[model samples]
Target: MRPARQTALEKVLPQIAIESPEAALDFPFTPEKVWLEIGFGNGDALAHWHHEFPNTGFIGCEPFINGVSNFCKLVANDDLKNIRIWNDIAQPLMAALPDASIDRVYLLNSDPWPKKRHHRRRVIQQESLDTLWRIMKPGALLILTTDHQSLAEWMLEQTLRHSKFEWTAKCKADWQTPPEGWLTTRYEGKGAVAGRSQVYLTFRKVDCE
Candidate 1:
C-alpha cells in the first residue's frame, strides 16, 4: 500500500488494489464534482484539467503501472490536490463507485489493440459503457477523442446505440478541435504532429426513471 494514499483509498478496494470509488466520493473533498479520466497516460491532460477546473475532483484510472506512477509524479510536481487514482482495472473501480456519482469523463485516443481478434481488450465496450452510464450523473459530459477513423466510428456507433447517451455534435468544428485549455496529451500531440485527423465526440447521459 502506498502509505501516502492509504487513508482515503484503502480496502474500499477489492483485493485487486482498487481505490474504492465509493470511498473516493466520501473522502475529504473540496472539488465540487468528480470527473473520471480513463487511461490517463502520463497524466498530461489530467493535470491540465485539474488546474483548469480547480473546483472539480478527478479520478484517473490506468491499469498500467508506469502510467499510474507518471500520473502520481505529475500530481505531486504540480501540487494538485483535486486528483485521486485507481491504479487498476476500471471495472472493479467503477463497481465500487456510487451510481450517478461522476460529473464528466474523458477517454482520449485509447489503445486501438488494432488486431481484429483483440477487440475485446478495448476499454470502450458495451459493458464498460453500461458501467460508465451507471456511474455518471445525468446530463454529465463524456468526452471521447480518437485519431483512428474506424475506431472513432465504432465508438460513435456504440454510444449512438446506447439509449441513455446523446451525441451532442452540431458541426464539424465540434469534432475538429477540443475546447480551449485542453492540454495536448502525449498520444494526441504526436498524432497531430504526424498529421492524423482527430475526432472529438461528446455525449451527455440522460436521466432515467
Candidate 2:
C-alpha cells in the first residue's frame, strides 16, 4: 500500500470500520437500505455505489489490506458516512447479521480460484448461498459479475440450485447485459481489453411464504 493509503487505513478506518457484525446495520443515520459486497477488490465498485446511493448504507468486506486502505482513503477524501468496512472474510459477518437484514448483495468479479483443486475456495457455494438467503430480505437482489467463464458457470449453477433464489434473467441477453449505469472497475476494464466476456447474474430472494 502507498503511504497515503496506509495513513488512511490507520486514521480513517477507525471512524467507519465495522468492529462487530452484530452492529453492522447501526449506521450513523438510518439508511433507506443496506447493501453488502463480499470481496470488494480495490473498492472501486463499493466506492462508486456509495457515491451513487447516498441513502443506502454499504458494508464492504475485503480480506486484502490494500483494498481496505484504498477504500478508507475514499471515505476520508469524500467524508462519506454511509459506508462501513469489514476487513476480513465475509462469512463471519454474514452469519452474524439478522435475518432479512440486507437489501442487496454484490459479488463482482471476485477471485475465481480457477484451479479445479481450489474450487472449494470459490465464494459461491451451497453453504454461503444458504447464509445469503437467510440474511437478504425477501425480494432482495444478489448481483454477481465475473469475467472468468468457468467461474460464471459455477456461480450460475450454485445460485440456480438454491431453492430460495430465483434467477431474474428471462433470456440470454439478460445475463449478457450489464445492469443500467454499471460502473466498470479497473480490473473489469482490463478483462474487456483482453477480450474476456463478462457475465452479469442477478437472483432475487424468494419470499417462499
Candidate 3:
C-alpha cells in the first residue's frame, strides 16, 4: 500500500474494518438489508452501491492490500457510514456471519484462472456456493458478472447445478445487459475497451424446507 493509503487506512480502520464476526457494525441508521461484495476490486461498485442505497449495510471483502486501501479511502472521503470491510478472503467471514443474514451478494469480474489446471481455484466453486447459500436469505439475489466467456459459462453451470439457486434470466438480453441500477467497475471498463462483452447473471436463493 502507498504511504498515503496506509495513513488513510490507519485513520479509518477503527470505523470501517470488521475486526471480528462477533463485533456488530455501528451503522448510522438501521439498514433494511445487508449486502456483501466479494473481491471488490478498487471498490468502484461497492462505493456506488453505498451511495445509491444509503440505508443498506454493505460488507466488502478484498484480500488485496491496494484494493482494501482504495476502499478505505472511499469510505473516508465519502463519509460512508453503512459500510464495513474484511481485508481478507470471504470464506471465513461468511462462515462467521449468522445464517441467512445477507440479502444480496455480488461477485463481479472475479479472477477467471483461465488455465485448465487452475479452474479449481476459481471463486465460483461448489464449496463456495454452499457457503453462499448458507449465508444468503431465501429469495435473496446472488449477482455474478464476468467478461470472460469461460468464466461466465462456468458460473452458470455451477449455480445451475446447485439446487439452492434459480436463474432469473428470462431471455438472452437479460443476461447480456446490465441489471437495473448497475454500476460499472474499472475491470468491466477495461473489458469494454477491449471489445469484450460481459454477462450479468442473477440467481435467486430458493426457499428450501
Candidate 4:
C-alpha cells in the first residue's frame, strides 16, 4: 500500500471499523437509512454514495486488504462519519443483523467465479439471498451490476427465482440502462472500454420474513 493509504489504515480504520458483527448495527452517528455494499472493490461507489447521502449510514463489506486500505483513505480524506467498515465477508454481519435492518444493498461488479465448479463461490447464491431477504426491509432495493455476460445472466436468474424479491425492470431497456445516480467504477469503466456491455439488475424485497 502507498504511504498515505498505510497511514490512513493505521489512524482511521479503528475509528470506523466494524470490529464484530454485533458492532455493525451500532453506528457512531445516527442515520435515516442503512446501506450495505458487498465486496466494495476499491470503495469508489461506496464513497460516492456516502457523499451523496450524508444522512444515510453505509456498511461496506470487503475482505481484500488493499480495498480496505483504499476505503480508509477515503474516510480519512472526507472525514465521513456515517459509514462503517466490515473488513470481512458479509454473511456474518448479515446473520448478526436483526430482521428488516438494511434498507438497501449493492452487489456491484462482483467476482464472476466463472468456472462451473467455482460457481458455488459466487456471492449471489441461494443461501446468501435467503439471508439478504431476512435482513432487508420490505420494499428495500437489492441492486446488482456486472459486465460479465454469464455472471449477469446468472445474477438475474438467481435473483428472479428467489420468491421474496420482485424484479423492478419493466422492459429490456430497464436492465440495459444504468439506474439514476449510478456511479461508474474503475472496473466497470475498464470493461466498457473493452467493449463489454454491462447489465444492471434491480430487485425489491417483498413480503420479507
After aligning candidate 2 to the native by TM-score, how far in Å is the CA of 155 from where it should be? 0.7
lDDT of 1 by residue, 34-72 (tens): 898888877789877887887888888887766665555
Off by over 4 Å in 4: none
Which of 3 and 4 is the better model by lDDT? 4
Ranking by lDDT: 2, 4, 3, 1
Best by lDDT: 2
Give one digit per residue, the lDDT tens place, for model 2 in 77-156. 77568998888999999999999999999999989999999999999999999999999998999999999999999999
Model 4 global lDDT (CA atoms, 0 to 1): 0.90
Model 3, 1-209: lDDT tens per residue? 78888987888767788887654344667789999999998999998888888889999889997988877777777766888888888878887887888999999999999999999999999999998998899899999999999999999999999878999999999999999777889999999999999999999999885
* lDDT, residue 29, model 2: 93
Model 4 per-residue lDDT tens digits across residues 155-186: 98898888789999999999999998888998
TM-score rank order: 4, 2, 3, 1
TM-score of each: 0.85, 0.96, 0.94, 0.97
Worst 10 residues of 1 by lDDT: 7-16
Q: Give each model's whole-structure lDDT.
A: 0.77, 0.91, 0.88, 0.90
TM-score of 2: 0.96
